[model samples]
Target: MAAVKLPTQRLYGTSFTCQISERNKDPPVGDEVWGTLVKEFSDVPDASAITRITVRLVIAAVLGGVLGFERESKGRSAGLRTHMLVAVGAALFVLGPLQSGMQIGDLSRVLQGVVQGIGFLGAGAIIIRSAQREVEGLTTAASIWATAAIGVMAGLGMEVTAVLSTAIVLVILAAVPHILPTPSETDSKSIGDD
Candidate 1:
């Protein structure tokens, strides 16, 4: 990687540098767009890397779907697609940097970012109604967080770990209900008060 100084822009007094490669100084348009497409698909010269990435991504999706399918059957709001997207997105977050030659040690930052970002996404699923004293979507939010972790494991080539983790999550989401009622169910139990 060659160091080439480029232009920087400041927003809110913070500088952001954008690099334009020599080949991309003038991006292709119209008929030449195919070249860009080919370049992207061919970015990874190693055939093994392509297969590795593809398998990992597919595994992540399947594991995520397993969790999502259960939630969808239970009529949860963040169902199949949400869980699948979260998993695939998390997998890409890890895959992209590693494919770009980033070391595993450097991945701590990436993992941290994924966890923080997923937390916000999970937060969106939670709703607290002060008037009713009822909180909803806590389980769905937690499921999304767990799904992200599963995706990360898949991305790191720990497919067995990801599969095992999914099994545990499934047991929690499916089997554990017999022993313990969820927050929403607990709230419903108190509906007699209302």
Candidate 2:
């Protein structure tokens, strides 16, 4: 008797399971495809001090969420939830080192690496569609970077600073746009218009 072939599993992120069947690879019979499927998975971290990590994640989420809320209110592409998740994830990543209480050299290097690493994400947020006709996401990109910073701060147990920074971020997000001048008009005219 022949053994049955098992479906392949694809892991997503770090805990979700995604099963891919052989049939899914079959070529489309017609120009119009019916049900295209893709598997997604993430690995959930298993640890004793899950609660502590969870707390850090939540704090980072809240900090990012605060900024995300501002963006959402303005109808930006990356909104509250996206920001929250990014911040929280970054915070948790930082917590691993912090909780272990590792060497000073390792910790310092990790800190620098974290800042440098977030740049990739920030870069993704910023895109110039055209040379003269540039469309920028400066605010959103900056918010993402700030969110990461807040996560690091939270991971370091700077809870008060995290919370205060979140609040200040919200306030600045709200007030800055209103006070800034429009690009179409001259500086004096723009201020006057405001």
Whose TM-score is greatest here?
1
lDDT values for all models: 0.88, 0.71
Worst 10 residues of 2 by lDDT: 35-44
Give the per-residue lDDT of model 1 (tens digit) for 55-153. Answer: 999999999999999999998888999999999999999999988899999999999999999999999988778798766788899999999999999
Residue-wise C-alpha lDDT for candidate 2, range 62-153, written one tens digit per residue:
78888999888887767888788778767766777766667656887787787787787777766565544555676777777788888888
True-vs-predicted CA distance for residue 138, candidate 1, Å: 0.7
For each of the candidates, give the backbone clash count. Answer: 0, 8
* Candidate 2 collision pairs: 12-41, 12-42, 14-43, 15-42, 15-43, 15-44, 16-41, 16-42
Candidate 1, residue 107: CA error in Å? 0.8
Off by over 4 Å in 1: 1-40, 181-194
CA RMSD per model (angstroms)? 14.9, 15.8
Local error of candidate 2 at residue 193 (angstroms): 17
> What C-alpha root-mean-square deviation, in Å, does candidate 1 show against the real structure?
14.9
